[model samples]
Target: MEVFKQHCQIAEEYHEVKKEIALLEERKKELLAKFEQAEKEKLDAAQLAREYEALAEENRTLKLAQSQCIEQLEKLRIQYQKRQGSS
Candidate 1:
């Protein structure tokens, strides 16, 4: 009878350990999913930053070109005025 009681106790302990292990595994999976989502968000943010930088550079280039064009127009106007005055 004592041996039977010991066997029952061991079995119960085994089941409890198994249940704990299953719970831990489930928690691990949840944490992994969250980690994956965070990594994806990080990558997305980095990509957006890169795209924003490229756009900023392009805007700078366009502004520089516009300024140069304005300067050229003014120079041409002055030259035209001088030629007209001479005539």
Candidate 2:
């Protein structure tokens, strides 16, 4: 009967749609996991950036201190030379 054939066709179409939906659900789960991974990487990168900045600031401060010490040593050497000349 034509009615039986139509019902069978509808059932087949329903099954096909169901299979597609199941595949989409799996894809959605995979995509969600990827999104989480990306967020974690971004957070890690930000933390590293902060640590790098702190290290750079410390290095700059150390360089400044080293320059001051060198300047003091040069001044002391000049004073010593003058004292020796006057003696």
Candidate 3:
């Protein structure tokens, strides 16, 4: 009878250890999924930053071109006025 009791106790402990292992494996999978998601977000943010910088540079170039055109137009207007006054 004592041997039988000992066998039952061992079996119970074995089952408990198996349950603990299963729980630990499930937690590990959850952590891995979160890590992968964070990496993806980081890459996306970097891409957006690069695109924004390109757009800002284009905006600056366009503004400079516009200023030069306006200056040229003003010079042409002044020349026209001088010719009219001489006539």
Q: Report the number of clashing residue pairs per model.
A: 0, 0, 0
- The count of backbone overlaps in candidate 2 is 0
Candidate 2 worst ten-residue window by lDDT: 31-40
Off by over 4 Å in 1: 83-87
- Ordered from best to worst TM-score, the candidate numbers read 1, 3, 2
What would the per-residue lDDT of candidate 3 be over residues 1-87, giving only the tens digit for each residue?
Answer: 999999999999999999999999999999999999999999999999999999999999999999999999999999999999999
What is the model-wide C-alpha lDDT for candidate 1? 1.00
- Per-residue lDDT of 1-87 in model 1, one digit per residue for the tens? 999999999999999999999999999999999999999999999999999999999999999999999999999999999999999
Residue ranges of candidate 2 with Cα displaced over 4 Å = 1-11
Candidate 3 vs. truth: CA RMSD? 2.1
The local distance difference test score of model 2 is 1.00
Candidate 2 clashing pairs? none
User: RMSD per prediction, one decimal?
Assistant: 1.6, 2.6, 2.1
